[model samples]
Structure formats: C-alpha cells, structure tokens
Target: MKFLKQFGIILGVSFIGEVLKYFIPLPIPASIYGLVIMLLLLSVKIVSVEQVKDTGSYLIEIMPVMFIPAAVGLITMWSELKSLWFPLCVITVVTTVIVMAAAGRVTQFIIRMEKRQKE
Candidate 1:
C-alpha cells in the first residue's frame, strides 16, 4: 500500500538516474545524481516529504550496512595500505581539510546570496 508507493517512487527516481548516468558524461556518481533529482522534486513540491519519509528513514537506518563492503575491501588492502600509510594519511588529512574549507566557503556564499535576495 503506502510502503509500496514509497518504494515505487524511490525505484523510479533511481532508475531515471541510472538511465541519465548511462547517457550523460558526468564524473559524479549516479546515486548522487539521483539524490539531486529527488531533492529538486521535493523542493518543487512535485513529491511531498510525507510520501518519501518512510523510505528515506529506512535507507538512512541501513546506511551503515552499505559501508560494510567498502570496509572489507579496505581491510583486504591492508598490506598494500601499510606500505603507503604515511603518504595516504597525509593525503587523506589534506584532502579533508581542503574539502571542509571549500564547503564552508560555499555555504557562506549561498547564505549571503540568500540574504541579499531577501533584502
């Protein structure tokens, strides 16, 4: 019933994203594109939050499980990782800092733009 409807919406959005990914030559992940599409739909009131809340919550609850395979793959690469540990750590830390800084700047810019529009 309601659950099936929500599942159908999620599946439909994901399928459309996959189709676009195959046709588009973007570097971003298809799931991210799907998320963007979903967000746009929600923002435009084409899809109500109530319609997707259950499915969204269920996905969020199971998010940790999605990382298990990636974690296992990393574990299997431990030996190779150990050899490059120092460089990997440096790169990871540097990239994280850069990403954080960039995100903060983008957020500030967006907020300022919104404020200007309001004023």
Candidate 2:
C-alpha cells in the first residue's frame, strides 16, 4: 500500500510531464521532464524523500531489466545498424566522454561548495 502510493506519485509526475510535452514545442522527452519535476518536488520539500525512497530504490535495482527490450531490438536491427556502425560507435564514444567530463566537473563543483560550507 505504501509502495503503491509512492508509485502513484511517480506516475502522477510522469503524467504531468506528458501533458507538458503536449503543450510545449520542444523535442524533449516526457521522462526527462518527470525527472526534473521529481527533483524539484523533493528539493523544495513539496514531496518528502522518505515517501518515495524505498520504491525508487526498488525501481533502480531493477532498472537493468528495462534495457532487455532495447537490447533485443538492437539485435533484431543488426543488419540496418551494421552499415552505420562506425559512425554510431564514434558518436557514442564522443558523447560518453563529454557526459563523463561534464558529470565529473559538476560533482567536483558540488563537493567544493560543500567543503566551503563546512569551513
């Protein structure tokens, strides 16, 4: 019952995201919007972390299972993807490096801020 309530909150946020997507012209995904909404709600104390923490942790634990269908789809589309494999690989590596660098910088900045606050 508690998990259901938390999951319901998540679904409500996602539904709001979908509605925003319908009205907005941007190509962004509803999932991203929902994530942002969830973050804001938690940060602002509009939604307590404890309310969703357990359910969220459970979902995260099973996240790898979510990729199974994507993996299968890739396998099924191997013939088409084979022709663009080189370019795809290059793009993947480049984007991965960029994301890693950006994340590292962000984490460093946050750590510095926390240290300064403690000093």
Best by lDDT: 2
Note the residue pairs that clash in candidate 2.
none
lDDT of 1 by residue, 23-76 (tens): 999887888889999999999999999999998899899999999999999999
In model 2, where do residues sit more than 4 Å from their true spots? none
Query: What TM-score, to 2 decimals, does candidate 2 have?
Result: 0.95
Candidate 1 achieves a global lDDT of 0.94
Query: Who wins the TM-score comparison?
Result: 2
Q: What overall lDDT goes with each candidate model?
A: 0.94, 0.96
Residue 96, candidate 1: alpha-carbon lDDT: 100
Could you tell me how far off, in angstroms, the CA of residue 46 lies in candidate 1 after the best superposition?
1.4
Q: In model 1, which runs have C-alpha deviations exceeding 4 angstroms?
A: none
Report the C-alpha displacement of residue 40, candidate 2, in angstroms: 0.8
